[model samples]
Target chain A: MTKTRLTRRALLAGTAAAATAATLKAPAIAQNAPIKIGVITDRVANSAMWATLMGEGVELATKQVNDAGGVLGRRIELAWEDDQDRPDVSATRARKLIGDGVVMILSLSSSTAAQQAQTATLEGKVPHMSPSHSADTLTTRLNNPYFFQMGPLASFQIRTLMAYAGTRFRRVALLTDNSALGTVNATSFRQGLQQGNIQIVADETFERGVTDVTPALQRVRAANPEGIFHAGILGAEMALFFRTYHQMGLRQPVLGSFNLSIPTYLDLVPGLLEGVQFIDVYDDVKPEVVDFANRYKAVHNKDPFSLPAYGYDGIMLTVDALRRAGAPDREKLRDAMHATRNYTAVIGARGTTIGFAPDRRIGFPENGCVVRTIANNKHGHAVWRGLAAS
Target chain B: MTDLLELAVSILEAGGIYALMALAYLVVLRPTGIINFAVGEWATLASFFSVATLGWWNLPYIPGAVLALAGVAAIGALTEQATVRPMIERGAPILTPILILLGMVVVYREAAALGFGTQNLRVPPPLGFGRIDLGPIAIPMQSAVVIAVSGIMLAGTWAFFERTIWGKAFQAVAIDRVAAGLMGINLRLVAAFSFAGGAAIAGTAGVLQAPLTSAHYLMGLPLAIKGFSALVIGGVGRVEGCILGGLVLAACERLVMRYAPIPSGFAIGVPLLLMILFLLVRPTGLIGARGRT
Candidate 1:
């Protein structure tokens, strides 16, 4: 009877030990450390509408990765910071994000602010991605392996516009506001036109906030260019220009930058903006674009602007790099980012096979622009594709 | 030469409006010894109200003009009574009254922004759109009307001050408020009258300029700067000097743009350069006293 009792006690002890081993192994399999991605944007917490859309993108991307069994059995976590459209503020935010163990950072907007964050990211050896800023200097002159841009650079868009203008118009005139962005676009456009064997009849600049553009437009009219291209955001100046241009009896075709099709421009000018053409990276009518837009609308109850799409794609690209790297190591991630060959994004098809060739750190697909023309003053229709060379 | 002539006409039209705004500033400055920084705000507010009256309410232009002018004048008088009169009663210094006007400027600008969104509105010109040709030079008909109205108002103002009893009372109050009060002139009434008149003139300028350049909350700042610059250049507190200064500044800017080797965008810099030159050479301005009081 004593022997049987001792055997029963040994069997009970074995069962207890087995249960403890299984519990410990379950945690190892179920609870992988989350990969932390730092998303620094100017949209969230600053503007209500932008905050919601951009926030949803980060949230959606994180959820998608987690739902798909995550990267290497580890779920993704996004830590966001608002730059508030200031460079100094963004730099401080980027440092804080780096200190918090974020492997990569995503900039919300503004080329100037992104450059500021990029400097900090390079110092910290953390990768930074910008969704909307297209400044060539960010990608070319300050080519840091840690930095990648998801949108087409300003030079690319300007070259495409100049190519089209060379074929259609004999002489092109440039009218730009006296802003940093405007000046860069104007200079790039001039260089592109020259390269394309097109002549510039006139180039004029106006004060940043000038409401009355009649005087400037009158001077441009005296030059009698085949077409006029205005490089500025659409607001009061755009409305004033259209009204004054119509009043002055100038029927020359007007081309504008991507800002021409923004909601503010449509709301302000209404019927006056008909027949205007602009260059954009994404068109809402395209199947891929429409699907994303509808999903964005369904989720956020508002149509997504081009900025949010770039932002979403930027986050996804970072995830792609992480997957390729197999870990969150800085050097490996940078290599994976640079080696991206052909990766499709919500904005358009981003070639993963093509990426930052050590010399070019910015990740932008060539021929990313699609030409859109205003049809009924309310909506813009895409008319051309693949203007920039691949 | 033809281009120069065309520019001159343009300058005259712009100058006429500036001169009117300057005169409005002088009307308040001469009587109250206070520079109403809110003068342009008053004009901006009146222009917006005029648009609301005509466009939103579907009233005729004449009624809208009258209502806007009268309403702005009343606001001016009330503001003086509520804000300025108490300070004057407390025997505050001259700068204190000026500061009050500066505060009013901020309040008025914010109020306008709150009342009307930041979007620019199109205000149709009061006169029909057409150009009147003066031989080789053609000018907008609106320009002629602005000049004519300014001349009539200036002449009427001169007559009132020089010939009428109430105008004499106003001048007496302006020259010496204590003495005017001792002589049984109602000091408060005269002060209110000056503010109302100044505001009305500003309202007229607003009504005139709105049709050419649409109304916006921020439009007042540049206009105020130009009007004040004219006031300083023409000799502070002098109506005729203000008019002359406005015309000279506008003409010089236009002429510089037409003939200067620099681009037209740099035209504003010319007036600023002239202002600096004038300050260095003739501190008293073209018509002001040579030395400090």
Candidate 2:
């Protein structure tokens, strides 16, 4: 209302003041903006079945974080890309996700694809992790400081099972499928058996899509092994093996890999897998798992399985780092994540935690995996814990 | 002797599936001259449909399975109607249709993946999940039914070609398309019929296998490879060749791997080796195409 001087100096000064004010407000608005995290999953491939549940866990945790006032006053936003279970595709997708400003990545695809995506993650200096129950090559094949794997390795399951088998049975046969991971598990199981001085009577592998496994089963029975160590990952192959075993009236106790922990096998051949035992990273009565199952059911209207719990653990680990990071920054979060210790996770045994004590890249605790027995034809409860199973 | 008998029974069950798939390829290849690698996807889609209708919707098993099969046949007709007819009208090369059919493989697989997700779905065995203990000849009840079904389909397809007027029209077109057209046979109609008929046979194979393998989208490619191998081993000429080739291929796969003192991986190579031998020695297969140019 009070007009003073119409000088050019006065007008320039006012414009500069306005510009400075906006500059000051920018970081505050950005601080309140959602921080996007990248998620690479195999949506339209064979791994999609596992990836879907893991993705749901990530989404649930994201929603819960946002609802509880976000991390460091900034909400978490997940950018999703389906890798199609291809290694090259996952690498390209990782670069694309990084370009889109994701501070971190959670790979929920196949382990091989996740391993390849580490190429981009290492180059981009983006913190990446696979919260899936997976193979160990992601940590062993690369020395990427930014990538972390939070699951028991394929070798860990074998050692644990061997420890459980102990002197109880001196002769054991190993049966596996012909898939790549199946071969890796077979090598691990064989090494575990040989190191324990257990007699390997028969080592057999059936083809992936082969409908009949009677020939392989007959060979195992002929060897007269006291027990059978099953390294089959595919549902159909495992079902065929069980059916043939029952048909032959072989009474050897069967020990299986963590892959059998998947609930899909419950419906494959009912009444065939009643007393089978397998290795897993879950104890049904653990407080953290119990809480997670209750919370998941409260929202999803069904029970949460092992896959979802691993996913929830992955995101929570990321969120914890972000909280201590004090900013939505890739570098700061990476440093903060590297410094994490003794995180109370929803996976593993009752007192098992998520901490990278000796091995930095492999975040799962040494004693995290447990051997569970199938009771009443389901992955019922954990009966043994630790690396040696004793 | 028991091992040999069990191995033979095993061969029959696996061979039945491969035979059905080979017949599907032959049925389409006869009139259209297109190998239709998508036949495996057709089988895969039919299995997915049956599992959804029967498992998820809890529909009565027989009606659900038949309806799913009919649905796949309709898709086959629509596929030919949409793609092949136009391409033929434009006089695309024979290799062009083959390439187009390959693209349809992706389309069908992605469709099932989208509709069903990535989960392995089960198709309740129409014969139920049990075994038939015929003395020392104990076999799964589903496998016995599958073998019977395969036999009936093969017999019916053989009779149709040997006796029916439509079947003769198909043979005439396969031998001489232009002459068949000159004699008042509809070439387009035969093409559509072959695709629909091929889909029905392949879909039956898929339904039969769903109980064994648990139907999945990734299942199509492996089966397509095996089916093509069976056709290569058997011959493209006579319908019975499909069964003979299928059984032979199955025997080579199971027997050699089970009894042979070599690496198990070599067993997979044995069939491929036989296929190469057949292609080089006698390209017409075990039964040569009579009027095939």
Candidate 3:
């Protein structure tokens, strides 16, 4: 009888120990399972650099998360699809990612492509975010609850720049190219100027191909406004604009849209952009930014631009939502993403954090825009970070 | 008056580049009567070659430029042999070669984009970015270099067409292809020479202008349109007419933008408007054929 009781107790203890060991092994097995995420990018387009920079940030952030044991005990796996910056291609890629069973999708393409991808995300009920597109239409054009935009909208950029330059110049001239984005940015800028009661002394536009901008510059020179607002986004056209502006000896202060935040200009338009201030979302002096830059450079062997911060924040935000949801359930993830608040954004001005309200899908704060100066052919420091109401 | 002087300088600076492209169009159009829109793509290809030889390999400007232009000329000859010659030898219509050249434009652009990617590539100016002042008139050194080089090229081209026996053969072919063929001039050889010369001129324009605009894959279409407009405005008959058309088109474009009280964006329409006006009102163009009577 004593031997039988001892054997029964041993069996009970052994069963309980085996059950605990199995429970621990379960998570490790799940951790080895890859939680696939999809990234739609423009690998070959006019805006390839921006796409590359954004994708680099995503890759860097994804590595960091996996290093930290990943979300929900699963390693994050990124499946990439090149959109070629075409809207149709972007939509098709988004659907294909959904079909491939990705938990979420991140897009870093033009606003048009991003907006098109929204249709696929909405139909598939998968959460989607665009980290670099600035067009306001991405959120407003579609009531896709699963879609979110993180970049500063065109209106926000123009308004922020106007607020920064308030009372500095009563009359300002606008210079932009005929490219679609340039035209759109210029129009938003025009509307902002009109609302500010500022006079536009001259409005000049140049084509993408013509190297000579002097005729347009001559007209602007004749008008002789107190300042010049550059809304052109094309690198070659903007280079022509600055070269012409410098050659014509125009002394008026030149302010630019947020497009200047692109780092390619530092190399493309050297020595021509000094003394020019452009609206940006990055504050180089921020500690978080410095840390991110260091880590990114260590991994990529190159300095990180402000644009990458958006991509980093995008992946982090999605992972944070995933962590809160604790499962790959699309509905729960969507709800968690929509509830994001007080999250620290690596990009944007000081004191600004990314959040999405119940009513709004655009995640960037109103005060996130900052004005940065260019000096010695490189982006300098933030000159102004406004908290004024939009 | 300063504005006027500066405007004139802008015209010259722009016209110089446009003239080179217009002349490229004229070269092929004169002898073959086939409008090769691929000249712009040839220029863009040369720009990419410059980026490789000059920017990547750190070659000196003169040798780098000669290599790029020569490479494009050879490519042009290959293109003629592969696409144009075969089609013509098969008794295809004149429109067949034109259409084939159009197809080559897309092929060349895609090849460059695939090889170099779609980023804008920067080439340092042959001269530094400083400006040279001619009294009250100031010109960027690159612009002045472009003007000087284009002037020499245009003069050389004029002499080639007028003074050289081979050039006279091209003119004779332009006047009447059947008569020139009847006169024992090899049509195939004439076609190859025209394509080679045209491609070289276009490539020179690309190498010179790449510093200003950066060599991009998408730069070809706009250039092709502008060059075609220049051809339409200057007339296809004379080499000098091509240069004259480029200058006039550039001048009118600037002058209208400067004094027309039109919105700055409207200035882009000036070239298209001029092209249409020339096609509708002055189809023979500003300089018609020398022996039209």
Candidate 4:
């Protein structure tokens, strides 16, 4: 009977009123929808050799957060993509993830891939974090406010390592594989040595996957440096370095970058790494790390060493920020991430905390870097802590 | 002079590895005329299997290595049957199969990575990591064993080609696939067997080279490149050429790295330079392909 009196204008007004009502109710339905987080991991690229472990770390953290009841009373659902370690693909994947209503993205691919993904993340106004990349240029290459890096920078590791070993060897040799990251590490290590006023006796690089470096090692032996500072990450090449080192009967102490901190070497070089020392974040015996290691052991039946702890800390901190933001809104959540301080993570020294200050995008403290010795072919005791003064 | 002597002995071990990798390519290329770039992945897969059997499952070295080789051979044969055979049957150009084989390289590589995670799996050298001294010259124990095993493999492959019926069939197919088929040679069988043998050779090289390079998913590409370079320098026609090419390539690389005034990084290009020189001087390689009856 009421509709019998309806005109075209009245009908249009009624439909508009109903549409507005549905729009108002949309937020209530979205409130219970799971918070979407994206992770770009590489499983097919060369970086996958280490990225797999980092991705596993990311997986475990996401699992723990979900098991503990996700943020803001909404379940946290993770969207995963493989970047194939290509920077272009990485940017494309980042855009795809951001387009899918993701609040934030974690790049667990190569540093360059992560760096490239920043373009998309910045454009989308989504907070992005490279939780385990150590490329110094990752932060400085772009002035994007949305990007934060938590990995120990090469400069920090180099300086800390120099503080521990530079005084003992005034003349050092720089060695690395021809990998992009390997070259980057070696360059910084050279700088770190120069800053310490140490003479660089020889510089060498070997191709990855080649079985023989004895030819190259012969030259290093001829140089007769007091120490060999290596920055290689390829397990095979790294092991070859050690094998060639021993084969040539060279007795120089081999100091390494954080690459040695990875547990793969223990399985690879084995008996070869007796007196080798390398730089790392800190001791794994810290209470937080022990807990993380225990959790890892419960599932994997083997205690994790260095990489997974970083992932756990990254996710835990991100979750805390999301909670502090009180909603999954991107701007508010990024602000909360920016305001973070005094946060605890399983990475770095026991007392060292990860946070963003007003002027710094690097979350890992400079002094948090440590130098550890390989004992029994394991990531051994931390012999020194904090960054070395220039 | 002492350093030079030490360096010379090291090349024997390095060259043997490149030789086997070259043989892997040759084994497939001879019968089907398709350059199987996937040989490196086959090698890597075998290395992973050997690691699993010997390291993880605690199988004895002989059985583990054998199982790995046999399994990869089967996979290689299956690959030919699945991919190569169908293309040939459909009258596809040789380039089609070569392109397809390139695609298989990625497939096999990703399969390897998925099947075996990227952890560094060490295949402990059968001979311990000690040094063996040849009078004034010194060699790693693993290197000597690897060189000896490589020699035996080369001899065995030589005997097969020169003395066995199947090897003759392989050669005949390489000479003329259609004519060989007309002569009652099973083209499919030849193709499959050649692929299997090629893959096994690759597996052998991988296991032997593990001491130096270690085993990982990413280990294949470099092996493929080195082998390809050796192939280019050695020529594909003669089995002996593979060994010759590998030795020359290794010698060039080592000599450059050790004696060249250039930085160690530049030494990497020595193999390519040598290959190019060979191409210019002897386009057919150091050992020209002999006419097979």
Candidate 5:
């Protein structure tokens, strides 16, 4: 084992020497032999919008990094593959990216796809980082040290939202659609509510394409819950719920999950979301986030949301680890990535930094989520600063 | 008391769209004996048209809706020409056209997705947002509009079958395709018209419902399933059966949501469960096809 380590170190040293001698300028290195990072994203599945935004974030960050002297004196190059939102295809894409000599892989698809991609990534021993997959089981399902997760965990989101909810609501209703992600969020929210000893007065679900959510909301109103937990993710269904809620004239405050963190709802369900609070990963109060938003808008000519920040942070974090590793070796880079602590990204709550303990591979802290409420149907301002709010 | 009134309005509003979707399926099923799952996609397409006209162009609701429905009807005729007529001409099996239409469903969705991105396009309600009072019942304006529209459509459909010669021709063709052909009724014309009407009906549903759900590519499948289930529950026979099936399905689903002790997640399966139950117990549905006599 000692000899193997020595040989690996020697090989890495020789590669580093060659990389240094190849080019003095980062652009020259980019033109010649640049460091490659693979990104797996869903381009056409249910989460396509989220994936596209995240991919754009990755691109913007990579461009910025390459503009400056690239990581470890070599320019950063990205190899992107569409997983098509299928787990099996994601696994195949992971193998393909590894074959293409990607030093590390960043996944911006569903948690299922990210988990499946880890199978190939684990075998290849390549470091894989999922920027936005929050399922707690992703890192726990496999004991692969090569994989790391860095998003607001479902548990974290639920806890944060519930914390924002406080003791003001004794009896609350849980609302979500039948979509898989919505169902998962509802289940997680239920567990969080139970643990917090909050009484779930009503639990309701509606089909996605239905014209009305009144029956469900009426039931919720009948139960006379103090507040309603909106856990549904589908934009259309959520709009229906809000509209029905307003039409029914129910005065209960609505608390939404991280799904409402998506800015798409601001446009889709305008006027109906006034005073409704939802868990958010993006905090405008953060200097880093302000800088990211200003730069992103200047580049894309549009306001940047949190979805892209997840991708941006994933690539930035990967590069940070590579810079620390000082070489293109996979094992060394994995160790460097796992050692990350207090690294701030554009997407979390103010004062929350990206950190991973020795045993835990999930990089996002439990307190890194905030609750934001919609006002005037345009802006979603941060209402509760962080999860620490009682 | 107010909650129950609101619930009744909600059920009526939902059932109206379901009824229209069921009628769309029944229109094609009656004469062609083919289940065109593509009606759902046609509804999705109409929603895009509404988005273009109503949302983008800021057209009035009536004109925008009419144009969208007309566009969908043309697409239906074109689709029948492209997919159905050729298969029928070659004397393909019944399943062949059904499967082909199923393939068209994917084509329509992909076309929409490629044309309009995966984001949900905002669709404003036709009569604007808010509520109206019909005596003691407070109903959303959009829901009230939906009920009115579906009533007109059902009335129109019933009148055509009962009052018009073309409607009798359609009935003749549905009764016995070969016998109607022998009677000199143009089967091709009837088939094309049936599909066009079906598309128009489906497009109407999409346009009316778009205010609530918005225009989306993935929105087609759930509608197709729910509409198909309604068709099965109402039976493939009469126009009234479609309305009956839709109302019954909506009522059952809503009641389950309001009262079922199960998790709300399980309530979503009520429609499917009802469909399965109907298929098992009353395969002919609540109202089977109208007799030939």
Candidate 6:
């Protein structure tokens, strides 16, 4: 009887060992199947160094996921297309990526183009994430289940800026361009100013390509506002504005939008750009910012712009959802992405929840805006943090 | 009043640049019936060459300017031979040749952008730091140089067109190309000369304007449009009309800014308004031929 009982115990132990082996080997077998993802961006190989950095960010994120055992036990493969920074081109690229079997699309750095991609993604039932476009319409008017924004939209930045300006100045002047993006930001700023009970002394606009703003500055100077909020892209006009404003001796504090942070603006205006303030979502020098910048610089021989961080975060988010879903099914991935909550990203707010409600199409943590001043031609310490009251 | 004076000075400066561009248009139009849409691209290419010569190679400014002008003149002559000759030989429609010029413009702009990245480039002013004080108003030495260059070029062009035998030959071709061809004029040589002179003037404008506004791919488009407007206002195929029209349009734009509460883009509309008034009063343009229209 004792011999029979010992034999039975040995059989039971063998069965348990087999079960453990199957459990471990099953995941390894499943992981052998590669998971393919398509990324569409404006980073044409022939574009500026910034576009190359964006491509590197996507590649790095994909490699990291593959290195750490990819989503749903499958290695992630990234397929990319260049949108060339055009809306129609991006839209077409999105459609082609979706047709080519991509689960999601990543966009280049403009709101107009993102909107086009979002429309294409929604129709194709694929998720679209924009890394650089800051237009509020992407989250508001065009919000959909397949669309997500990883960066603060323009309305958020403008509202935050207006609230901050209200604390210091009573009267303000605004100079904007005639572009749609400029109009939206200016309108949001005007609303924010009204909410803050700040007086708008002068409101003016110029054409996008105007080489000089002397006449516009003269009008604003006549209003004698204490500060000027310039809402325009970094182009010939900004250089003209600085030269004209300096020549005219308009000493009022000048603040610009994100366009001011562009490296081109720094190169063009140089010392004249000092004291200008602008909003930025991420700064590379910040310790909290991710390791992607270092990796990007190592690979591309240049510092990554704010776009790459968001691109890295976007791909990581998609991978995390796929991992959590534990399947290559599109429906499961979509559900898993929507269910994302308190997800941490390298560029996003730390210790913050990232999820989407059924009514809300975009992930939230959208409330961080850092006001940076150009000190000695470098972005100085943050003047304010967190979301300012609208 | 002081503001008005400042506006006037700005207008004059802008007008001077437009005048140089208009002279380029007049140079080609007077010799050949074809209006080269590639004028802006030629100027942009010349400017990039100037930037390369002066900024990259560390060449002296005067030699760099001359080299840029000479290089662009060669390019202009080559364009006439390679592109214009083919169209003319094929007996293509007038618009076909014009469209070809437009395509050349795109190619040249893209080529420049590819070669020099899309970033704005700064070119050091030829004139040293100095400003002319007109009482309370101060104008930079660069502006004075631009005005002086425009005057010199305009005078030189007038002498070349009106005083020299070659100038009469050019005028004779403009009056009757077939008749001048029958009279043993080398039509191809005249076309080559026109391209060279037009390109040199454009190169000069590019170098002078680079200091005030940085050089870039898209810089020439707006300037070209303004030049066309000046040409239309002055009357097409008229040199004196182009100069007068450019100055008048610039003055009107500045005056509108000084007095009217107009949007900055709408300031360009002032010239259109003047063009309309000129069309009504003098249908041939401000200095165009009587009863030609």
Cα lDDT, all candidates? 0.71, 0.84, 0.85, 0.84, 0.85, 0.72
Better of 1 and 4 by DockQ: 4
Candidate 3 chain B minimal-lDDT segment of 10 residues: B284-293
Model 2 TM-score on a 0 to 1 scale = 0.93
lDDT of predicted model 3: 0.85
Off by over 4 Å in 2: A1-31, A388-390, B263-266
Q: Top DockQ: which candidate number?
A: 4
Better structure of 1 and 5 per DockQ: 5
lDDT of 1 by residue, B197-246 (tens): 98888877777766655666666766676677666677664567777877
Candidate 1 local lDDT, A323-384, one digit each (tens)? 89998887898889878866666664232222666666766665666667877765565565
For residues B29-132, could you state the per-residue lDDT of candidate 2 as single tens digits?
A: 98888989999999999999998788888899778888889989999999999988899899899888889899999999999988887777777877776778
How would you encode candidate 5's per-residue C-alpha lDDT over A226-274 as one tens digit per residue? 9888787778888778787887788999888777877787787787888
Give the true-contact fraction for every prediction, in order: 0.06, 0.43, 0.63, 0.79, 0.72, 0.26
Highest TM-score model number: 2
Quality of candidate 4 docking, DockQ:
0.66
For candidate 1 chain B, the 10 contiguous residues with the lowest summed lDDT are B284-293
Clashing residue pairs for model 2? none
Off by over 4 Å in 6: A1-86, A288-290, A327-329, A346-358, A362-366, A388-390, B127-134, B268-283, B289-293
Q: Ten consecutive residues with minimal summed lDDT in candidate 5 chain B?
A: B259-268
lDDT tens string, model 5, B1-293?
A: 77677768777877878888999998998888998999889899999999998988999888988998999999998889989999999999999999999999888988998888888888888777788877777788988888899889988998999899999898888888899999999999998899999999999889888888788887877777778888889988888888888898888877776767775556668788889999999999999887551
Q: Which lDDT value does model 1 have at A213?
A: 50
Model 3 Cα displacement at A191 (Å)? 2.3
Q: What is the per-residue lDDT of model 3 for residues A1-390, given as tens digits with 9 covering 90 to 100?
A: 999999999999999999999888776726366888899988766566578778889999999998887888888899999998898999999999999999889998777788889999999999999876777677888899999888887778878887787678889998888866677788888888989999999998887787688878888888889999988888778777877778788899989988888877767667878889998888888888999999999998887877788889889889999988889778899999989987877878888888899899888887888888888878888888854632
TM-score of chain A of each: 0.83, 0.89, 0.90, 0.89, 0.90, 0.82
Local accuracy of candidate 2 as per-residue lDDT tens digits, A48-143: 878888888888888888888778877888999999989999999999999999999999978888989999999999999999645767787889
* Ranking according to TM-score, highest score first: 2, 5, 4, 3, 6, 1
Candidate structures ordered by DockQ, highest first: 4, 2, 5, 3, 6, 1
Model 3 Cα lDDT, one tens digit per residue, B1-293: 77888887778877888888999999998888789999899999999999988989888999988898999999999999999999999999999999999999889988998898777788878888888888887878888888898899999999999999998898888888889899999999999989999999999888888888888887777777788888889887887788889999899888887888787667677778988999999998898866521
Per-prediction DockQ comes to 0.10, 0.57, 0.45, 0.66, 0.56, 0.20
Q: Write the per-residue lDDT of candidate 4 for residues A1-390, one digit (tens) a residue.
A: 556667766988999999998888664425588889898988887687667787667778888877776778777788999999999999999999999999889888788899899999999999999888888888898998999898888888888887777789888889998887888888888888998999988888887676788878878878889999998777888888888788778999988888788878887878889888887874676788888888888877887766777667778888989999999999988888888897878888767888999887889888887778878767776777776532
